[model samples]
Target: MAAVKLSGKSILALLLMYVVLIFVLQMWVGPRDRWAGYSVLTPLVAAALLPFRRTLLVGAFTLLAITGSYGFGVTGLSVGARFVVIMATALSFGISLIVCRVRLEREERVKRLMVARDRLSLLSAASSRVGGTLDVTSTARELAEVAALRFADSVTVDLFEPVLRGEDPQDLPADGCVTLRRAAHVTAVAATGRETTALRANSAGAGQNREVHVPARWLDPGRPAATRVLEGGEIGASGLPMPLPSAGTGAEGWVTAIAVPLTAGKATLGLAVFARGPGRAPFDADDLMLAEEIAMRAGVCVDNARRYTRERETSLTLQQSLLPDRPPEQQAADVATRYIPAGSQAGVGGDWFDVIPLSGARVALVVGDVVGHGVQASATMGRLRSAVRTLADIDLPPDELLTHLDDIVVKLSAESLGDHGTTPRGDIGATCLYAVYDPVSRDCTLASAGHPVPALRTPDGVCEFVDLPPGPPLGLGGLPFESVTLSLPEDSLIALYSDGLVESRHRDIDAGFKELKQVLAQHAGALEATCDNTLKVLVDDPPQDDVAVLLACTRALDASQVAVWEFARDPAVVSQAREAVSRQLSRWGLEGAVLTTELVVSELVTNAIRYGSGPVQLRLIRQKTLICEVSDGCNTAPHLRRARTYDEGGRGLFIIANVTERWGTRQSRRGKTIWTEQALAP
Candidate 1:
């Protein structure tokens, strides 16, 4: 229950009644009568109107008035009356003292309650202001600002270097010296008026704003109270003599300071220092306890942010390692690519692109996206990219390549279900687009597995999306994928991209396509320029998903750069094939390569006629490398094996491999094409 307060009017009335009673008692019964004891009420009433000290003064004055009335004999009194007046005076003085003590105790209790309320308010503010972000720097700055505004006139936060880098804390030095990086510093505007000179000096030569270094012995366990607090993960107070590099010369105005350790679990990450200027009361026990609470809360937030940062960096590194370092160079097209990962908060996504060089002067352009983010998605992307390259090397058509990829994804999903006993949602799903451009035929064949269609820009700067059938995304079985073939003019631009470039929350896929077409038409100068301009116009902020874009400008080989011939199924045509190859080389001014070319043609034709069927053909093309191809009507592919010194039957393909830079066989509609490439003369 609340204490009842006496009004000024009531208190005055009580004092007057006490005086009247004294006068009436003295007038009716002598001044020293036994009823004079009632005058003690005068001093008790005064205690309600005045403070403890003033109440004592009023009690002394009333006692003197009683003694004077008896000493002057203002009324006839016996010895007993004198004794009664003395007793009443003594009782009033003692009772007034008791009343003053009670009032003082009540006032002290109210002050404590107010202090407790303020501390609770500070703790609430700390919880709301700090740890609101996963960024270490931002969290530290917020902690400092809140402390300075609510608890102290100035605040500074310092963290170990490894802690700032999202690493676990190391053991403290045995020699009592510690190294710390100043992370945040904030002061009350009214208290500091301007930036401190020491802060300015510390930041003058620092490379980053919050990375100033401070060396101090105060962090040692035995140095001072503040140091003890840090070493023990407790709270301690200190004077200005302690080393505080963050405060610098501004420490002169700091009359009292408290240091609390920022600890997460068993590790100590840093320290928070709160300081009060002159004229402010020094931090008491309650203040130190409150500071410790704030530090503990902020510590957990900082540690959580650090852990998140570390995980993000790890994911990014894994994704980057999985991506191709550089696109392969091919004769059919010039390729340029761009890849940007999502922000740290969004984590890393599985977006990848590749340029694979195929046989017959054909180049494969690929862009793919995995459904989720983080290391698992990146690992899946790597596996899929490897599978695609392997399939492309075997000369699979674009549609067949995607079919094989879909089978792999379905197998992966099944394996995941077997391992975890639950079907994953969107985890194993992926989208991809594969395109093969043949310069010899001046045609491109493309296929999509639930991926966006590519954009094509003609030599005249007109852009449009390729109309292709969209198949089910990878990981879904029993789906048929179809391929679309289009004839592109020489110098035409073809762009393959992941959906991140054309889809966002605010824009639909069709709107994204329109913007892409506009950008491509506006900047159609070079492959690299087109890629840069497309990303610049399409991505104004950090995309929600990873982005991968690949641009290639097509170039076709003219009729003069190629030669073709058809031969009968007779073994006698081997010599005819060699003669045709030599004449073609001479006409193309590759006379220096004629002798080796004749040998290569002789071995290839002799084998095709000996082990193969009828209707053999031969072709040669001039590009970055001179390519010689032999096709037969048989489905069998020849292999290269080491021939015994005593045997001559299995040395034809071996001899071709040694005389040329490289050789391979690819299956064609009719049979297989055995091809060899030799480096052109410098």
Candidate 2:
């Protein structure tokens, strides 16, 4: 309805009906009787209509009608009639004034409740939405979107890191519709506990920008506080100035802003702000309070998510670095090494095993487990492994090498023990095994320090753990370790494993070893396949701990299959070797490579007779690769160097080096073997 028309018509119509009603009432009912009832009814009706202007107007008209007709327009009236009319009008006006006051209070209360509900709802949503997220950037984006949807017309988030001083501000997203760098905004919010905003007019006109600063009235700058405040720690309040309808331009265009502090555990994490241009609806105290609640919950969720993300990233990187792109190729006796970290932690570990070539025709085999996992364990494993190689190069016996390692551990523990003062036992301790094997003699010597015994699986499918005296664990001294010697029969397979393979929580060490033996027995025959199958049995699915396994087999060529020809220091020796090669070549029915072998054999025998030792032995074997070995008591090893045009003596080694596809020298305590290999006939 038009305000002017409704007001004028309502007043005129009301006045006209007032006269008519009073006149009729006075004539029909005695004025003396009506005064008391009219007096009571007028003020009661006026008071009932304290909230609505329409109710007030209608009630006033009714009162005037009754009073005017009964007191003035009627044929006869008593003294009480005038008193009733005057008192009724006065009471109606007084009630109308009181109603106006009450209406204002009710409106304010409703606005406050709505604002409070909005703030509460926003906080509740933020808590539930971001609590478990593991990515910080994604969480920031989510918070920004939630803030925009809940509080203001638009929202943006920028992460400010003061420690990272070299960052570019332009790269950051705009925050809360304000044109401020993210780093700058973070500084501002942190310093003042306030949010900056650009005012928006309405939901449709929210695009307009009007820069404004909110006061940090809720925070005390001098008081020390944590980064977050716990829920219910602080009460929140908000206020927004109302604009007059008739006010124009600058004076009337006052913007409204609301703020809620995001707090957890007595500290504020951040702040959320809502704002709009002039002519927008004003915010109530409850809005700011509700915002604070939402902020508090959001703060906790963000912190958790960030921590989770950091740990996940670090673990992933460490795991990748620990794992090799591919395992080492098949070594002596067809060895394959497969390493898998515990899937749960995704961290690097110190579990390692290796098949290292020794000075003689032996392999120095080892498998060890460090006390822990992750970056520290990985680094320690690297150091220990290097030490093992160094000790091996020095020709230290297995037992002596282990003793040296124990000494190193003792020193390391003593030096670093003070760092771990909180723990009763400081620093990590390791378990290790060192073994040396000679394929020729089929002899294996092993030493252990608190490590599980290596198992031997014979060609006939018999499996048994090696029996050895237990020694003290590394880093702790109680008893000295002694080497154990075992005859590894030809075609026998030996397996070394870390305790993680068989040691389950429910079983003791002996039971674990028994389990390993049972697993080996189940998968016998194929050495490589059995090793893999045994590992699978011991590991099962979802292994609770880390596992490392190394397996090797001994193969000895029979005397009939391998022929050795010995010669003395004489020209006849070279002729003898040539005749022997020719006879073998003819017997084997070989022709093309046979001449090359004879020439190589004659030249090697000539050199051995001329410049070398007490005795020389030439052995030929029909194996996977053609094996031709020359052994001499001379400790001096022969080298094939780049021969000059005038060089004659080094030509023998040069020819041998060229003919051999694969060759190596092994120095033993007694003598050294210079073995050269030719590819087998198809």
lDDT of each: 0.78, 0.59
Cα lDDT tens digits, model 1, 1-682, are: 9999977556656666666667556655642465556666778877766677667766776777677666564566677767777776878888888987898789889989988898888889889989887777678877887776457766777787787777776676655346666677665544354534433332233322344333334443234443322211222222212334344325455666777767788777776778776546778767767887898899998998788777777777887887878886778988899998876567678889999988888889999999888777888898999999999999888889999999999888776664366755445889999999999999999999999999999998889889999888998878899999999999998889998898877788888999999988875466787788889888747787889999988999999998999998788888888888888998989998999999988888888888899788899999879999999989899888999999958888888888899899998778999999999977
Tell me how many clashing residue pairs each candidate has: 1, 17
What does candidate 2's lDDT look like per residue over 1-682, in tens digits?
7665445445446544654555466567664455435444543444443345554665566566656654565655467756666676657656665765587688889987886676667777676665544444445445654565345432333232311121221222223222311211111111122233211122122221222232343332222233222121121122222322322214533355444443445543334444433434455545445545555566555555545544444544554454444334322355555555654433345677877765434568888887776566666666777788778765567888899988877776666555465433437678899998866666788999888888888878889888976577788854588899888777677888887787766676677788788877765456668767777766745455678888777656455455678887777778788888777766766666677788778777776676677888887765555567777777677886887998655677777777877666666666777777677678
User: For this target, which candidate reaches the highest TM-score against the unseen true structure?
Assistant: 1
Best by lDDT: 1
Once superposed on the true structure, which residue ranges of model 1 sit more than 4 Å away at CA?
A: 1-121, 191-252, 414-426, 505-510, 645-648
Which ten contiguous residues of candidate 2 have the minimum total lDDT? 183-192
Any residue pairs clashing in model 1, and if so which? 32-81
Q: Candidate 2: what lDDT?
A: 0.59
